[model samples]
Target: MLALQPVDTVAPAFRPEPVTQEEAAAMFRAALGLFGKWELTDDQAATLLDMPVRTYRRWKAEGPGRISRDGCARLSNLMGIHKALRIIFAEARRGYGWIKAGNDAFAGSSALDVMLGGELTDLMRVRRYLDATRGGW
Candidate 1:
């Protein structure tokens, strides 16, 4: 006769709160600031955000409006990547410079280049790379 032991299931400890419109707007504004710090042109920023160039320009000039969930996600990933870079490099300039610097991990392409793939997953990939490099989530 064989006895079967019960398996214990554990729930996740952390659950994120739903993002509010204000929070989304704030993230959009912050992403614009990050673009300036990273010296990303409008086209590059739009590409990274997975938005049309016209929309990006409009948002930049008129202010944050109707940021979709996917757009917020892209902004969040960009912020996460920036934070990881800040933690990894003591100098802020170094962190900014690193975005455009070639890396073997990205197949000799800059992190910005990888992110310019114009997909939400592309932004996430850069964030994941930075997180892994810095030994953080």
Candidate 2:
């Protein structure tokens, strides 16, 4: 006879590591470059960054110094999405254009549209979708 012990079903609490100021600035720069590669307009970039258009412009012009925690998370997610796209699509053009290409998974909405919703989760959703496409999940 064997006795089975109940496994702990509770998930571990998520504790995100503190991002350094320099790291945040670098991520912001990378995210901006990604937006450029995707041919995103200023408005689109602002939306993705989850900031107003004016604030985005100011940050772009002045360069990021100490971005908020949420801003860092958003940029990190954007960079992750970009990396996933690059991995999934062998062609650089395809990877860049995939953001605007309609997807069945998003009810025919483009990944760009989903990401433009200005929420961190929106970026994560698109990244997860691309990751799954590349058999990452």
RMSD of each: 5.9, 6.0
User: Model 1 clash pairs?
Assistant: none
* Off by more than 4 A, model 1: 1-15
How does model 2 fare in lDDT? 0.88
Clash counts per candidate, in order, are: 0, 0
Q: Candidate 1: deviation at residue 10, Å?
A: 8.8
Compute the lDDT for candidate 1.
0.90
**Using Cα atoms with residue i matched to residue i, what is each candidate's TM-score against the true structure?**
0.87, 0.85
lDDT for each of the candidates? 0.90, 0.88
lDDT of 1 at 61: 95
Top-lDDT structure, candidate number: 1
Those runs of model 2 whose alpha carbons end farther than 4 Å from true positions after fitting are 1-16
